[model samples]
Target: MKNVSTREPGLHKGVLYAMLAAALFGASTPFAKVFVGQVAPVSLAGVLYLGSGVGLLACFLVRALVQRGQVGQPVALTKPDLPWLAGAIAAGGVAGPVLLMVGLSMMPASSASLLLNMEGVLTAMLAWFVCKENFDRRIFIGMLLIVAAGALLSWEQVPVLGVPWGAFAILGACLCWAIDNNLTRKVSASDPLQIAMVKGLVAGIVNIAIALAFGYALPGAGTALAAGAVGFCGYGLSLVMFVLALRHLGTARTGAYFSAAPFVGAAISLIMLAEAPGATFWIAAALMGGGIWLHLTESHGHEHEHEAMEHLHAHSHDGHHQHEHDFEWDGSEPHAHPHQHVPQRHAHPHYPDIHHRHRH
Candidate 1:
């Protein structure tokens, strides 16, 4: 029997990654809202994602130069990873942002940001039922709380932009991203930066083409640059961190933690725009915060069996890792290489991590 003992380390680390991704992406919402005045909605979406793609591509180029002869490139994406990446770009990059930008154009940033929690609920549901990711009842309860919070955000006395159309647009955006989240999981083992960059590039190009077809004039360079900067942090860096969390936490859990993003955006929007949050906002915040706490503190422990598995990612010689090398190992504690997990049964706390996906 093998054990990846001390579940706190992995759980805490994955939570940290998810929160950071949330913060980055959430903060981008209000900022993107502000930029809506500077360009067409679709154009702004394109630029933001374009910036993310270009910035990450540059980082990857530098990384390659620095590790030209490295024995392992943990951040490299292969051909097998492309299909998932394409779907993520199409759903998340292209459709999601266009809907979000259009929604932001009509709704208050605070309201829009709060409504964005829908993505987590949708993502979790898809992961739990559709993807067949193993999870317990607690996750479902947390999902309900998040869904309730999202519903609260959609309450408007009078729906502008065509009778609650804005709120509906944001919900549509959430669905697109939910699909993207599931698709991205298929390639989560690959380099996250590479996946994000490709998604950004393809999505940016598609959205930009659509916007140009609509006859939106190019915005000033300053506006374009600012949107790009937002994209680099909110989309590029956030996605890289998100993929890291996904590798450790699985799709549903990762989305649950990422529910924190909209809160960050709401706080920033209130401060930046001097808008007030009403009763519904505070109520929704409490529900979401509670749900996020539940996911964060969760620890799944059971005597689960590990089927013989072979894959590669960043790792150390934890108890669960008991593989001999085909080549001379560099004798490092933590390294990335092809290793196999012999069948084992042990009782320990775990998540549905890359190694721990077993029947519950």
Candidate 2:
């Protein structure tokens, strides 16, 4: 049996990576907004996604070449894995970005920024339902407050957009991302770089085809360069970091950490573009902060148990192999016990002793 230990340093590294990804994602919003004026939504979406795909592919190819000996190795992708990959491409890579682009084109930056917060709420809910992740009542309530705060912050802009169909597009994006979050959890056992590359390539090609069919004009040199840079940062590097973090943090915690991106974007908009959100925006920000506090500070103290068994390999009196069993307890309270080993068809003990410990 293998002994598992809590590695605080690894958790810290995961948090740092997650936070950096969130920061990059947030900073990309303003840049994406800038390109909306110079290029059509569909075309912009295509260029951004495709560029991101190309960038990640390049990085992945280099890594693969460096580790060429490991190439063509058999991967255990069962029938269950395909649906998850498909769902991830559809939600996170395809639908989410398309909706976000369309909505940004039709609405105020501030409003769209707040609406993007919906991704967090949607993601958390999906993680809870689909992944059966543990979430206490306080976490749910905090999530609710965060959503309400976002609504409050963007309330004024809602009237300005005035029931535009494009707003629905943004909601679609959130739904796609929610689906993507759940799907990511399913495929997280795979290599993170490989997963990112596959998602980027598949989604990029599909988005580009859609963009071309929509009659969006190709942008000139300057806009193209800017869009490409934004794509690299927002989609490429950001996604790599996100996948790496997901491996350690899981979906729900990743979503909660990502919830800070919009606020970071909002701050960038204010500083770089001089776009100021009104009083309600600040109030919403406060609510989100409180929600974040609740999320980070609270912990559910649940006990987990692991079973370990030690057996002696010897011929048994029951015409089978016989063994002695030893049990060890490793948890908040320490105790030891011993049990008899019974051999059926196999020589090993049927039941093993379990060790219990708390996870951070």
Clashes of each: 0, 3
lDDT of 2 by residue, 79-144 (tens): 566788888988888778878877877877667766766888888887777656667688777777
My TM-score estimates for the predictions, one after another, are: 0.88, 0.72
The whole-model lDDT of each prediction reads: 0.81, 0.65
Candidate 1 lDDT, 1-360, residue by residue in tens: 555575754447877888899899989988887877667778877888889989999998999899787666664666777887888888888888888878887888667755776788789888988888988778778767766765565555543444788999999999999999999988887788788888878888888898899888766888888889999999899999999899888998888777767667777888897889888789989988878767766767878788888777767777788678888878765677778988878888877877876766
Quote the lDDT for 100 in model 1. Answer: 89
Prediction 1 global C-alpha lDDT: 0.81
Residue 234 lDDT in candidate 1: 96
